[model samples]
Target: MAVIRQLDSLAPDFDAQLELLLAWESVADHRVEETVAEILREVRAHGDVAVISYTNQFDRRQLQAAGDFMVSASELQAARERVAPEARRALEAAAERVRAYHDHQKQESWQYREADGTVLGQQITPMERVGIYVPGGKASYPSSVLMNAIPAKVAGVEEVVMVVPAPDNQISDLVLAAAAIAGVDRVFTIGGAQAVAALAYGTEAVPRVDKIVGPGNIFVASAKRAVFGQVAIDMIAGPSEILVICDGETDPDWIAMDLLSQAEHDEQAQSILVSPDQEFLDAVERALEKLLAELPRREIAAVSLKERGALVAVDSIESAIAISNRIAPEHLELSVANPEKYLPLIRNAGAIFLGRHTAEALGDYCAGPNHVLPTSGTARFSSPLGVYDFQKRSSIIYCSPEGAKTLGRVAGILARGEGLEAHARSAEYRVRNK
Candidate 1:
């Protein structure tokens, strides 16, 4: 039932559909902004009182003080006991895989010495503190906690604080267990724009952090956007999306199932398949029909597929890659023969899955790379969440008299070219005095 369009059917008007694909990118009404802004101001003004009140009103958890917000070690242990043995083992496996992948992302400080006695270096240091927002409701994501916190741990961040919404003052044992596994320093039962505000502007219970990282809903996104100056935040993530590039050789059933995997995330999700062969196109359409009836989330995935999904018949695999680059999808699958051959052509996409056996779902759970990625076309400029996100880099420079004389002359010349007299003098002072 998804929109099936032949290349010939795409008139200039069809470009409009491509644009509509960005509907989730629409910023909510200023009313939401004004409302969130007011909530932030309240948290800023009243500290813990406003946070507690809003938590009660929104999350329905009446907290008398900041201490009530924290999840204790006992609760975490209980969560481990409550979780199924299989689930716990699976989570442990996922954590191990994630840590192994991010270990490769850890940065090291390096210095380079010049012949003129100048030493230039870069020092990579972790943030002293960071806050992670994990969604509540149907959005309980223990996988996300592992994705966000393990990197901070790997980066040697001193403190990792987590804020999650819990409607009944009951936080998931599973999420708490994941936090424990990732070595989170604290867990707060608070969420929404108010939780973000609490993280940005320290409450009596929540300490202001240097950065915030994790996935959230629209309100959480807007709050992060609002608090950017006060605290660092990961990218304002767009909606979930997946693009599968298949050849006639791959099974249409696999293609259909893979496409639905992302579409089931939400009604606003996007799924698209690109292929050069029409026979494969027809087969995929038939497979989608057969599979769509069997899926438990058929209604949601069906609407998402029909509204935002696509089956594009490109002229060749090269054209498919060109089209995919333009889309800059969050997940790109090369479900073709020898996917490695085209890896060089893919300059965009948040993550790439090489070969038909490597499904995007592998990346979501047990695969090593983080699932938290830039969505929409932001992948064209951004990247997946990594240890680098948890750390900051500073330039290290040391110059002796000889080095100063050699470097300052060029610095003075550049400063003078920009008409920055003060800057020129600052550089020239070293050379002149030396």
Candidate 2:
């Protein structure tokens, strides 16, 4: 039977056990780094031809030219019409919800004037173009297309370029339709480190983007890391995570399934449950064993739970929340009677699901929040993807004649105190004989 690691706060070495369970270190694989470096170099040197060659070799495709895989407007339209009515409706609905939620996150430029008419504020500007990568190796992620692209569009990004791997020259229609709905300006059938390189440095076919945002395998992550200074990138996400704090009232079945949701993502993903009731933890474990047999991806989830998942018995609900904050989980679920009572105590999390009915999976799909989130323990400092990621802020300062005279004197004194006469004179010149 599949079993998740169990812990009790009353144990002598509980803290140590928890520490061991939560420990996640990503050591760089030298081979992966070298491979990505070579791909980047080739893409930079050969441009479109390089991208074409890499795609053919990696994705098992036979392509003649760079334009062979460029998705045209007609193809996008065809995809929109080709999808089943039910699937198309869900895509449209999810896209609309994502767009609506991000619309509220849009920032505007603002300024304020002082008595002397010295104005100061900020200007919000969208990036000219952005690239969003969608992983198409194991499964199709139309939702990813919406989550990454809509925010940029809502932030007023002019052009959105998307790249997805089409292994065997087959891509998903739903993904294409999603691109249409999310306002993606361009779509290309390419992925992996080469796709990242193409986006980072302009190729003959792929235009260089100001920023690249999305998730992918290790090759993509390493590529993004290698090209950090060349272009901005979203966070390097780790394995998916979910921490559930229950009061022992929720159905054991539900809690088990919630934990499995993260587990099914991969072997590294973690699903944790914390509650004061030891019997509840037992019940969840049994439920997990039962559910594991029924899942299509049972083997994957089984390994993930056996190795990475956990069930902890806390002293009380308060203690459970304390442990949660310390973990800084990516997804936190308060599956208790009154979930709001603990909101003030939650200082760290990428997203919070309140009450028993709010499944973390809902947030992953149509919950209207960006599913792209800080992973591992990054929730302690980072945040969920939003419109802000696609936008840039610039400080605005305008000094009036009188304001300059008053400020220049202070600036001149400060500059000279630092022993830079050139800087001091520049400031003093502004307020000279005022």
Candidate 3:
């Protein structure tokens, strides 16, 4: 019954066996949320003929219309000239290092002034369109198309589109040459929840998209949780976590191949491992039983290491980073030897992977960041998938009639002490005489 499960961070109901090994229960099943709420009310009322009748009934495809769901531009330039010049130089070096790490998270428009000249800051912008989904039949993620369309074309998104699903008509020419080397713009072949209801309710052949980033299945995560407020969505993700820690001087077969790289990503992935060395957690449980029998995904990492893997023993390394900030893992891996002196005691993680030859599969492809993280414990709140999730800030303000009469008499005495008589007569009509 036990292949992996060593637990005991001084057991005695060790936090109720680590909350029953990080209980998952990822919702979506009232007959898959009534078949994704009737496929989002039949694609918001038959748009593009209900996304070409749910892409010819769930991608078996014999589509006659909805312009046979786009994919042109000479089929992304004939799949970037039939790839394999060593996988198009590894998809143009993972889309030029994920577009130079989301061009250092772009974000511009500022402002300043004050001393009664009043003007405040912030503007940002970006999302005029975005969509990205990807997960097609039998997985071929060209690195989830450079981690979801190179951070929406490095956050200057003006289009992007994408989608995937082509079960029988088949898709993935390295996900169309990593969406023409990550400058996506368009491509479809439709997917589940009707390509997220043709990119969240817009279809004369899909258009509406102000935000919809990737990763799907479960009727595209219940149609991106039913077209979230008509668009913006990027986190319904769960299953896939790592944890790691280790200071027991590495290599128990490199922490059992970094816990079988998120336990071969399935059967609800978790894979844990802490250490204050109980003989390095019995030599990484016999190197996860001799590399889980030379995995070709050993039966989905042996039912995700015999149901949500583990291997603790801690009592130090500050009780394995306070049990890794109470399981807020997505992928952590500090394999120690001073991995930045325990990386500012890691508050919560979506991606950490420090020393011991840092590998959470090199941040899942060319390590340029945004592997679209924040799973399970939602890294305590949220993040990863950046170019600041395709920008959008706003804020600004302007004022200045002597800073609107000293901020309109301090906003008309805090808007009539919050009783709000028309917000205190609209801040006493800018206070010239209030």
Candidate 4:
């Protein structure tokens, strides 16, 4: 049987156990930080030379110049052609759905005039350029390309520069094909801290971007942290997580498989089930044991289950929800009969899987919602990546002569109270003599 822990909400030590289970420190180690810092400094100083050197060393590629790292337009088209017909169709379909979904998230400029003839509103505009990092080699993710690039395009971003490490000069054609479909403006075969540095501080070969988004290994994560002020970045994602709040009505096999889906991501990934049914929990436990032997990633999944996974028995569905809110998991599955009824009670979650039929895997792919989400309980404040992330908003305030005069007295009083003589005088100058 799997070594998953079983707990009851009524237990005296339940709170402490839950806290221990939820705790995870995503901080990069000192060695990684030191390495990344050195790379960032080198890249910032040497530009293309530093990038070329690091790419050659890390990716085991023989490159004479930085220009050779760029993937040509013909290469991208060839990748698209190389993909199987069925896979191409699936990619196109998924891209269309993702594009359509993010279209709703696009913000537009809006203004309104007050009675004093003052115009106040907001203006929305897209970032000129963005860099997206796609993990390469055996861990290639085509879905990530569509998820990151499509939203930027939908938001009217002019350039989407993508960087992926081609280890041993072997790149996944699926990833390249997806990039082509998503309308990426440029592609570079570079990875790690060097690629991030190239994007943050532009080299002659790689242009600097307004924002950098996507996932990478520890070195890349540290680089993103190191260069935060230089360019905007997406959230520092932690391990994948899934919290299933079942009502004991769903099939044990289905719930067990759902938990495994997240656990298979990695040993650090978490999968938990909260319900009021003890019998149902036992059934799921049995199902887990039976299914664990079948999965290809069973070793990793088993380790995750033993370390972080849990089967918690609560007093009621309401109690389960309260616990879930405290956990604030990355992916939440309301596997109960009336999932919608409980949605309002969910205060924090990166994404909410609505029904028993709606699997978390769907959201990762063709479900239309951007799967780039807040992880490690960050859903409490952060949100999923969307078109808004690619757009910037500027507050618009045009004060008419009459409006300035009307508001100057209030501003002058506030400025004087703050002990700023210059500010008071500036506002006083705008005030008309009565």
Candidate 5:
């Protein structure tokens, strides 16, 4: 029973419709902040002992020892062998595509000299170590491994340590295969808040890293959010979401199935559609009912669509674009004729799917763009995780005597305006000595 709110009839209540469809608000409650805080402190104090206790309690699995927790080379090789040849080929193809796309995002350290011989530039360097967390609960996303680790590897990070949960002391073969493809240096069997804490503070086995990245559950997100100052984090990701904008003429079945595709992700996931025609809206509703019946995750999809999804009929496509900008969805699909016409109008969206043929799922798997997009309406400010996340920048400036003398006056004036004598003296000293 997904809510169908007709925009024509409820023109004055568009705000309410927008609010109902915004699942991020509910998911952004930060409910586990205090819980994560306690776990982080305990893990920080007790180290590996705390991690083992929490894993056994929450994961309902026992680890004989810390040495047994680390994935051995033989174990990884066996997991790789277990992967079917076709799946391996597909993983390799995906790795190739991901590597190719991120290779272009690699940045170079640059410098330029002025007439006075002031050489000012930026020096790009890779982080010494980085940690990537991969979830292993109800679903396994091998693609996430490639998305998180490949960028760090390309950036020349010294070490890329990975942590994946073992709910029942089991890690999927696909995940291990993905780790191999992405060039992870170490793989640890840990997850949830403890995994994040271990990466941030460094357990006996897991090494502390300069930064941590990847997707995870609520406890994991809360732990990352809690340990922000100690180590860098990519972004505070919320639940997955997708929004599709269509004209009245598009196929209702296509629209309905597209919405459900993202809805099946989880109960907290949201799917939204905006169109101007009432007839098409009705058709999509019927299509959802017909199509949802066949899905294996029908119950989850039903709960998600009924509670968090929406269909809004705006007065026009222009109105739809305006509303979408305000919402700032993670994945935006334009199911309209000549969608490029509206491209310039989109000021906010993590990833833009061009037309009816370009569904969000394509972007999730094989598309060139990283699927690790900003969630919880963060597209307004944040960007997708990329090669830049793994690299650090340093200011490079070599001012010759003439260059220092030429630049000192301006620097001294600005320093004086700010009432900082030390800053002014430093610049004055350079010029006077020169």
Candidate 6:
């Protein structure tokens, strides 16, 4: 049985225990940092040679040239055809829904004219190129391809370059199919920090991308951190998390399975349940013990539950919401009757799954929302990956002569007050002499 922690709001040390539970240090290992720094430097200095050499050594592939890393268009098409009819249909359906949802998030350039004919507003444009790193081999995620690439396409990104490690030249057909469905412009069989470096600093083979986005192992995460300013990254995501706020009305078995879904993501993933019903919490715990034995990933889920999972018994549903807001989980499920009534009370959460039937797993795949969420309590300030992330906004201010003269005086005053003489003079030049 998983030794998941049980907490009560009435306990004297509950606050301290909660704090400890939520604490997760995202600090990269010093050795990993040093190694990433060396790899980045070599890639920057040597270009394609360094990337190709590292890719061959790390992925155990025997590629003669950097060009060999590129996965051809014909290959993608073959992979799409290789998929079973039912799976292909599911992928197509999911891609369509994801595309439809993100289309709404696409920002268009807008401007408003002032009385003096000054146009002021914002202009939105997608990045010229973007790189998406899809984890391959046993960790292949076709859903990730759809979630990351579809949004970039929806945002009108000119090129979407994808990199997936083909260890021993083995690549997942599902991933390739997903890429095809999502309209990825390019694919490279490169992984680790080298792939990141190649994307950040353009190599002879891999074109430089304006931004890099996707999830990977520790090395990929460190490399992303090292090359942040050189190129934009989606987010340095932490482990997956799910916090289910149930009012004891939802099925105990359903709640237990929902918690396990996140727990099975990895040993570090967290799964927590907050509810007012102590008896329901007990029922869920029993369900976890019984159902966990049946899961293929039981060991992983067990470790996660034993180490990071919790069942918090709160005084009321309002108390549960307050705790959830403080935790700011990556995914939140309101498995309660009248879930909509509690929506207003939720201030922070990467994604909110309302009602008893809406499982967090749906949001991960076909629920129409992007599942790439802000983890490690970052939902307090950050958001899920969307079209907005792939787009850039520029402030537009085309001041008319009359408007400039009127606004320049105000700007000059503020600049002078701040002791910026050059700024004051620049503004003064636009002001009327009177």
Q: Which order, best to worst by TM-score?
A: 2, 4, 6, 5, 1, 3
Global local distance difference test of model 3: 0.84
Q: Which of 2 and 6 is the better model by TM-score?
A: 2
Tens digit per residue, CA lDDT, model 4, 1-434? 44688989999999999999988878579999999999999999999899988888888988889778999888998999999999999999999999999999999999999998999999999999999999998787999999999999999999999999998999999999999999998999999999999999999999999999998888998899989999999979889999999999999999999999999999999999999999999999999988988999999999999999999999899999999888888899999987888889999899999888988999999999999999888999989999999999999999988888878888989999999989988877877553
Q: Model 2, range 1-434, lDDT digits (tens) per residue?
A: 44888888889999898889988866367999999999999999999899999999999999899889799988998999999999999999999999999999999999999999899999999999999999986598999999999999999999999999999988999999999988899999999999999999989899999999999999999999999999999989889999999999999999999999999999899999999999999999999999988999999998899889999999999999989999999999999998997899999899999999999999988989999999878899999999999999999989998988888889888999999999888877879867
> Per-prediction TM-score, please?
0.95, 0.98, 0.35, 0.98, 0.95, 0.97
Candidate 1: tens digits of C-alpha lDDT, residues 1-434: 24333342234665576666546645565878998999999999998899999989988777888888888877777787789899888889999999999999999999999987789999999999999998876456899999999999999999999999988866677898888888888888889999999999998889999999998877888899999999999988877899999987888899889999998898888898888898898898888888988999989988888878888777789988988998899999999999999999999999999998989999998899999988888899999999999889999999978999888899999999999999988988989897
Clashing pairs in 5: none
Model 6 worst lDDT run, 10 consecutive residues: 425-434
Worst lDDT 10-window in candidate 2: 21-30
State the C-alpha lDDT per candidate.
0.87, 0.93, 0.84, 0.93, 0.86, 0.93
- Each model's number of backbone clashes? 0, 0, 0, 0, 0, 0
Candidate 6 C-alpha lDDT tens digits along 1-434: 44588999889999999889887768489999999999999999998899888988999988888878988999999999999989899999999999999989988899999999899999998999999999997776999999999999999999999999999889899999999999999999999999999999999989999999999989999999999999999999999999999989889999999999999999999999999999999999999999999999999999999989999999999999999999999999998888899999999999999998999999888878898899998899999999999999999999888888988999999999999999988987877563
Model 4, residue 369: C-alpha shift (Å): 0.5
Query: Which structure is stronger by TM-score: 1 or 3?
Result: 1
The clash tally of candidate 2 reads 0
Residue-level error in angstroms, candidate 5, position 398? 0.8
How high is the lDDT of residue 432 in model 3?
52
Clashing residue pairs, backbone N/CA/C < 3 A, model 2: none
In candidate 6, list every pair of residues with a backbone clash: none
- The regions of model 3 sitting more than 4 angstroms off are 1-61, 67-117, 121-129, 139-162, 169-204, 208-212, 215-243, 246-258, 266-278, 290-296, 299-330, 333-344, 347-371, 374-383, 386-391, 395-434
